[model samples]
Every structure is written in structure tokens, then in C-alpha cells.
Target chain A: MAEEAAVGCARPTGGPVGEENQNETLQSQETLKEERSMIKVGQKAPDFIAPGYHKGAFVNVKLSDYLGKWVLLCFYPGDFTFV
Target chain B: MSIDSMFVHKMWNDHELEHMVKGGIPYPMLSDAGGKVGTVYGVYDENAGVEARGRFIIDPDGVVQGYEVLTPPVGRNVNETFRQLQAFQLVRETKGGEATPSGWRPGKKTLKPGINLVGKVWKEWKTTDAFD
Candidate 1:
């Protein structure tokens, strides 16, 4: 786990630390609202690097890394939930 | 992708990981506990506190070729996603000259798009033949 964290410490989306400031994050949600419209067909997908679970290890994944292949970004709720 | 932690995802998919052909899950199941990807994709329902079922098919250039977001109750069809991918790949290979018709599959007829084909698509396309 320590080694995994060391490899891909680059958190582009500020995900892991986002929960620290909920109030501030909520205020920033206003700016994020405008981003909703940008995610659409024919538009370039937003690039992100996040910790992904594969083969029992936490690995960083970048959307750009899959540039030459078809990428299926399937977003569901948390695992073991209703989804 | 889900908002679950990497640990949780590992625990959840343990069976598939251990027994799968490659000894791992077929694809990368991203952990978006912060809902970052969900927010960008507009699939996060902040009030409900969960991400809606969302699927995005991105082409080689990273452009979103097809996407769908459904309410939580509805699941997705992998076959349909694959079909769309194939259709987009075919059109991309042909450089917009060919288009897949309704329910079109590979080895099936494709429609040739042009000013002349605008109104005659229905009459020109058949399962065995393509528009001239």
C-alpha cells in the first residue's frame, strides 16, 4: 500500500483531499456547474488520473494513457452499494 | 468507475480477480470516492449522494463518440456499447463516407452519405447491398 501510494501520487482531480473542505467545495460547486455542459458527445473527454483498483493493486490511471484505444468510462455509485 | 475506495473495489471483485483468465479483473475499475469523474461527466446526483449509471465511449482521439446516463434503477448493456464502438470505428475508418444504418452490424450494408443520398436512404440501403 505504501509503495502503491508512492508510484502515482499525482492527484489531478484533488479527489482524496476534497472531503477536507466541504463548505469550500460546495461554494466551488458553482464554478463546476458550468462544466456540466462541456461533457457531451463530440467533445474531448476531461482528462483525469485517479487510483484505480486492478489485480488487487491501486494503480493510477490517466485518461490520456488510453489515447489510442476505445475508452469506456463507466461511472456507477460506490461498490457494494445498490449499483 | 465507482466512488468506492480501491480497497473496497478489491474486496468486492475478489472472486473475479482471482479466477479470471488473467488472474485479474478484465478492466480497470476506477475508484472515484470524491466523485470527481462523476461531477465532470454530469452523472453525480449530489442530493441522492450517488452517481447515476453513466457510460461514455471515447474514441482514439479522446473525443466522446457516444454516451448515456441513466437513473440508478437501469443497468447498462455491454453488447450495445460494443456495437456502438464498432459502428464508430467503421465510420472513422471510412472517413465519414459510410454510416451504419439502424441495427446495422459488421458484414451488413452501410449507407453512403452524400447530397444525393439525403432523401433516398430508405430506398437505397439493404441488408445485402449498399448505396452506389
Candidate 2:
């Protein structure tokens, strides 16, 4: 299910993510191994405090600090990987 | 977020991302030590010791509105993320009085979801309208 969510919007343009219309992308993309992440919609996003790198300095950013604003939290496989 | 430390993020930001985005990423690149943050989001791969590629769109009220998780080979679209953020904001600003149709962009036709709009969406919005 997460793989389906991942592949649909990964397309460059003209397609909304999570739409089942992208049958071609569904087939062309390899089936990924089962995942364990169980994040659900409409739930409170998990909060965390961590050290971050920004513009040549280390800063502490707390998830709660960004309250009252749209937060786009992105995760990737370590550093130096293609975004 | 990933398990990368602050120093690694610094190197990547200075050497790679800045070259790609002119002034580097305009947002903070967080260091998720031990994959703690990723684990809470369920994007952490214990065996791999890294977080899977994932993005969560959290609204101003701190609710998770949208999210995507992908593997390493596939790259997520930044433009699409922006589009979604704008769409979400528009819907919120309108206080749910307006809804964005699929593939909706700013200034495009927005649907006012209601009992009357339950089944007649095709009349108010057309496939061709999305392109206009």
C-alpha cells in the first residue's frame, strides 16, 4: 500500500499522487518489499526535537515549534542520497 | 529525516545540494539520530539502519493530511509537494467551503462539497477544466 502511495506521485508531472489511474507506473516500477511504517491520515503527526544542519550552522528544530504553520516533514535514506 | 549526523548534513548541503539549488535547501536538513524520528513516523528500516524516503504533509493544526513513502531508487517530486501544500492551504483558508479537485492548481475551479454536490461533480468540474 505504501509502495502504491510512493510510486503514483513520483511521476514528474500531470498526475496526482495516490491516484489509481497510473497503471503504467504501477507495472513499470518494481514491487518493493513489505514496509513497517503505519502512519495514518488525520492523526497528530509525531513530534520530535533534533539537531539540524542549515546554512553552515547547527540548529535545534523542534516539531512543536512549527505549530500554527504548514510543516512538510521529509525523510530519506541517510545523507548524499539522491532526493 | 535520516540517521545522518549534523556534520554529514553540512558536507552534503555545502558540496551537493547548494550546487543543485543555488543557495542550498531553504529548509533545515535534520539529523535523525538512531532513526528515532523515522521510527515514530514508521518510515525507519531497522535492518537497513536508515529511513525510507517519506514525506508527510502536516497541516497548521498539526494533523497529518497527506504522506508518501518511497524506496531509494525512486525520486519524489518537489513541485508536486508544493502543489499539494498550496491546495491544502486553499482548502483550509476557505474553511472547507471549497475543495480542490484532483490535479488542482491555484486559480483552477474549486468544488464546494455539499449534499447537492454529492454526485454532480462532473457538472461543476470537467476533466478539460483542469487543464484550463
| Best of the candidates, DockQ | 1
- Top candidate on TM-score is 2
In model 2, what lDDT does residue A6 have? Answer: 34
- Consecutive 10-residue window with the lowest summed lDDT within model 2 chain B: B43-52
Segments of candidate 2 deviating more than 4 angstroms? A1-37, B129-132
lDDT tens readout by residue for model 1, B52-103: 7889999999999989887765678888888888999999999999999877
**Candidate 2 residue lDDT tens string, B22-43:** 8888899899888878978988
Best by lDDT: 2
Q: What is the lDDT of residue B86 in candidate 2?
A: 94
Question: What DockQ does each candidate score versus the true complex, computed on alpha carbons?
Answer: 0.35, 0.33
lDDT of 1 by residue, A2-36 (tens): 33333221121223443457787788788767766
